[model samples]
Target: MKTIRLFSVLLFALSLSSALSQAAKPATVSVNRIGDGPIITPELDQRMGGNIQGPSLIKVPKWIENPIGQYYLYFADHRGEYIRMAYA
Candidate 1:
């Protein structure tokens, strides 16, 4: 019936829109000042993670454009901790 056909089309469109909505990632990131001095210190290293035994310094560029959320910061310490901090 025409009603069933229209309902099927509506459902398809709704499903497509829902998928697209879920696919979009938000563009949000945390930032730290480049020369603010010790965003993370040896004392605070434990908060960041184990093995982050030094002063934190920002080594990333001030401006980064990641619309798709493909980019990540990874660490603020010398150690390979799973941290993320952008510099601005």
Candidate 2:
């Protein structure tokens, strides 16, 4: 009984440490853009809007810090027809 209790405790401790280590790592995401050509600027892209074609997927590090303000980083995805947005 004592040996079983000690093993259980050790197993729990190991699991907790593993979880903590994984949690400590920064989050990441994949960015996918479906377009033919790259837009030169945000303003131009907004004005012209989806003038390009083709599809691309990029994996990049996620932003860790969010500023203390009203503005926030919004994530989005869309098909040629519909759009979606999420607050981070």
On residues 3-58, what C-alpha lDDT tens digit does candidate 1 reach at each position?
99999999999999999988968889897566867444446445665455433444
Against the correct fold, how does model 1 do in TM-score?
Answer: 0.28
- C-alpha RMSD by candidate, in order: 12.4, 13.5
Best by lDDT: 1
Residue 50, model 1: lDDT of 45
Summarize candidate 2's per-residue lDDT along 11-77 as a digit string, tens digits: 9999999998888666796667879774332344363254333333222345545534333333222
lDDT of each: 0.58, 0.49
Total backbone collisions for each predicted model: 0, 2
lDDT of 1 at 18: 92
TM-scores, one per candidate: 0.28, 0.29
Where does candidate 1 have its weakest 10-residue lDDT segment? 67-76
